[model samples]
Target: MRQNNHMLFRINLARRKFLRQGFSLLASAGIIGCGDSATTSATTPVVIPPDTDSNDTPGTLTTTSTPQQVVIIGAGISGLIAGYELQRAGHSVTILEARERVGGRVHTLVSPFTNGQFAEAGASRIPSTHNLTLAYAQHFSLALDPFYPSTNNYFYLQDNSVSLIDAEQHINQPPWPGAVNRSNFYKIRGGMANLPLALSNALAEHINYSSPVELIQQTNDQVTVITGQDQQFIADRVLCTVPLPVLTKISFSPPLSEEKHLASNGGYDYTNSTRLYSQFSQRFWHADNLNGWGDSNWPEEIWQPTWDNGESSGIIQSYLRDVAATELDTMDVEQQIANVHSRWQHVFPELDSYLLTNHIHSWQQEVWTGSAYASPTNLQDSALSAYIGLVEGRIHFAGEHASNFHGWIQGAIASGIRAANEIHNAN
Candidate 1:
């Protein structure tokens, strides 16, 4: 069933008002936008009680008193955190992950570099303002280090000559349109993957890797979730933390509400992006007194992953987003690597000899997650942002996109906590 045009018009007006109000509030608070390096007050970490009983069953909970069952779709950070919280509260949780791996965007490439050095192919840096992410890291006892070292770096802007600048100068430089200056960035010691690995390990027996959710059917009381392999899980509630685009692929028995359907199908912007990590035999760029982090007119950002790792061999990563990423997707891997190499060589001619091998990770090519992250394009449609964390009866929505802090792990964790609390309070 489609929503009436009149109702949609009203909803659109309301959304525009809401966004205007939100922007006004941000302006008053001196907040420019999301994903910026605004200093956030540090928060005290909450102590989560450890699960006492061990349940080997994949979809069962072990508690003195029986609790409500929750079937979580997608084993990404949001889903995993939701499952972890629900399980801690004595609720039965069954996480369905499409890929054999757990972390959706928090991927780390381990073997490409020598001396135990690695590079994060996705979701690398953690801003200090990301309290939930830091809190989770604290809970898991994961170590964090500065993502970028305070040093001089080279910037090769739009086929321009290389210019050297200090960290402060580079950070203070004006950002591109709708972009914020990022001053503080941190990362997990091993890789961003460790965050999900810790959560997944804690829920090892309850998570079903390689199990992709195919359909969700909601009755008056019970919700039934089916996987691609025809595995069915009947639960009192289902929290869907899958990306909005991915959620569109799963059939809903009662069908999503008209507004939700529109929001899922058209409202969200699944950023077309690609990340390339190149391993080098020696730290040639570092030896040249270059931080190996720079921006180019070719529409790519380059950074060294091994800056703080204390490793001789390092990995240089190139990030291409939006149109640049779309253009890169059309080319072959060899051509893409060649192009990146050519650009870097133009800035630092020494890179030609130091480059050993390269690995590419395209979020668009990833079937489970169709994009790098979700950024809503039609903010005027209030339903788009409203339906983000909205609970449709037995089904609850969560993910980075669903949260106000979209494109960050903090958003995912915040959404998971919100979804878990909603379920916890309901039943």
Candidate 2:
């Protein structure tokens, strides 16, 4: 979640200094400002409704199906919230998700070690500006924990040389030129997935998971969704929340409007590709007195070692940048581990003593989602406006990409609310 080179450089440098001092920067300059004051009672935890029971096979396309009150495609945050709001508006809503589970890109991975540690494979943090995400936490009694990225770090260059940087001073300064913008990134207290989990809990009855819509055809009147599993759902109003790249591939009976098509095509360029964060049960970085920041312009060299929930423990978690994507599938487990170890040797000379289990999440490999949410490029404004714009007839599009905030849980929620408002006003 970094942008603009100068900002990134400054933030990373400052982060290194802060971590080396164990968050002492917050005390000196009020950086993060006296820890989070937000807390919620454990007894009133957010409630997620029970799972659904329906299944649809892919081959049976039904044309005779009439329009439902409302239908949403994709159950990611946008889809989830859209359904939630629509149902709240008293319309019969159906959410068709291509994946088997909910939460879209917000994945909170529970570890097998059972030591109370978890890692997020997708969409991990929410900045203080993420109003929607924070609001839900407050409404559901979820606690807010501070995720301080301003700490010590290791830098890897193309020559494979490593440089240790102090986060405190580095963040306030510039790493290269544009690094200052990187300071806003933050992680959620419970987990990145908790926000979506909270929303899903609020809208359990209306969603249908594992239902990928293969075809979206609209006549003069209503839209019909044909699933890969052959089941069908018809609705008067349809909200498409699928990724832009995927949306371009799906066939729309008479074809979408020129603006919608252009938006879908143009939006792909903004998509942010990501390498999943690997989770281990131990905090190896703490043992070696390191802040788990190992970065390189080359993807393979930028393996980062991070701590789990525990501030102390010898088990360190690490994840390589997208560089590993090219060779990930071809390499064996032993080779992959060895490659990661090689990179760590540069940033963390003492890493060998505290290393534990290793896990990797390659978002590109996920069939449900090809990559992370879209990143805003120069083309962002027009493309986002196009995708978020109402079709004027009966179609609406909502998702993380459709949001102005873009690429976080809050964007999804905000877009969902926006789409709901659009539908409500049309009636």
Candidate 3:
């Protein structure tokens, strides 16, 4: 009977893996098809002319004789990529970033942890189906590793914990329905920030860090971008790549259309999310022969960030969203850390003595970001998605929120390429 149960677990795992991969393939193709707002425009179709140079790569744009001056807001992936592609096409580009650092939500932290262990505070994993993201990673020559290579996972519910491998016997049933089993998730080696760092390094001279955009004024022939520091930049075109929540802070000349304004204000759903990373002096979870990935009703989910890093010390991360995030937000940093530690201990008593240090990153409290990423409230609202990416006069919009692959790095890259292509074709 025991042998039969083990065989059943293996069979179920294989079946789940197959189904997950099939669904992922379909979803990727669907997102790619629906992600291009320029082609799916409701009003006038955006016509992207074929490359005049046959040798030009798909992502690279052809150089133009008359270069147009372009100003990009927010030095995130979308803005940086837009600036890089535009400059490569022989256009003068200037990028204005509100924060001292770039990479928007793709932040990686190394300090406060020992033994070369690191953790991602935001935007941790990349799905294999994200071709554009993969292309950029390949371009940068960044190494990739499985996000959760181990098949073993833990579930803590209602004050009880069980390994997924023994879940059937413990719970007298199979694992929870709709549980993801595929190993398609990946993270960049060194850190996820390496992605934006590569793009930033390529456009070092063009990026103006700590320059926050205040307002934008566009005319028939030119557009003017004003910074909070009272500096003004004039360009032939401007791309607004700031997050929707942050975008609301910037004023536009003549104001945006009512629909667009509303969309930027709150039409999209930006989840209140928080991430906590805790490093331990010893690999307590691994010593128990259990993968340090877990989920619970209390804190949404938790995973081991240093699982594939071959580090003796371990880093476990917890993600809290919605109400859990709100509840934690009310507490002080120390209180929040204690709360997470206590809750993690409740799930795994072994973690109590091994924890050495902890760090917290609250996206809800992040000034420029406000929230993690935007999600469509109404799934059928294709126009809502398409409208955000539409070119508004000489001003353009590009971000993860504007793409169908919302919340992923791929969305940002695709949006940036689309915006750059729009400017290049116009030239």
CA lDDT, every model vs. true structure: 0.71, 0.56, 0.72
State which candidate, 2 or 3, has the greater lDDT. 3
lDDT of 2 at 311: 35
| Residue range 1-427, candidate 2, lDDT tens digits | 2222322242222323323332232123221110111122122222222213221111111222232488888888777766765665566788887776788888877663345556666675555444455444444445443343455553444446766665554344533364332344445556777766766777788777778888888876788888888988777888888877667656787778776677667544444343433333345554444556545544542423123243343233344433345565457777766765676566556556655556666665677666666665666564446444455467787777776556777667666766765665554
Report model 2's TM-score to 2 decimal places: 0.72
What digit string (tens of lDDT, one per residue) describes model 1 on residues 84-175?
A: 87897698888888888899988888876677778777798875545456556655666665555555665665684677667766554434
Which has the higher lDDT value, candidate number 1 or candidate number 2?
A: 1
Error of 2 at 73 (Å): 1.1
Candidate 3: global Cα-lDDT? 0.72
Candidate whose lDDT is highest: 3
* Candidate 1 worst ten-residue window by lDDT: 33-42
- The lowest-lDDT stretch of 10 consecutive residues in candidate 3 is 33-42
Could you give the candidate ranking by lDDT, starting with the highest?
Answer: 3, 1, 2
Score candidate 3 by TM-score against the native. Answer: 0.82
lDDT of 3 by residue, 308-378 (tens): 55567788888888889889899999999888877777656777678788888888788899888887677
Off by over 4 Å in 2: 1-68, 111-114, 149-159, 170-185, 262-267, 270-284, 299-308, 311-335, 350-354, 376-389
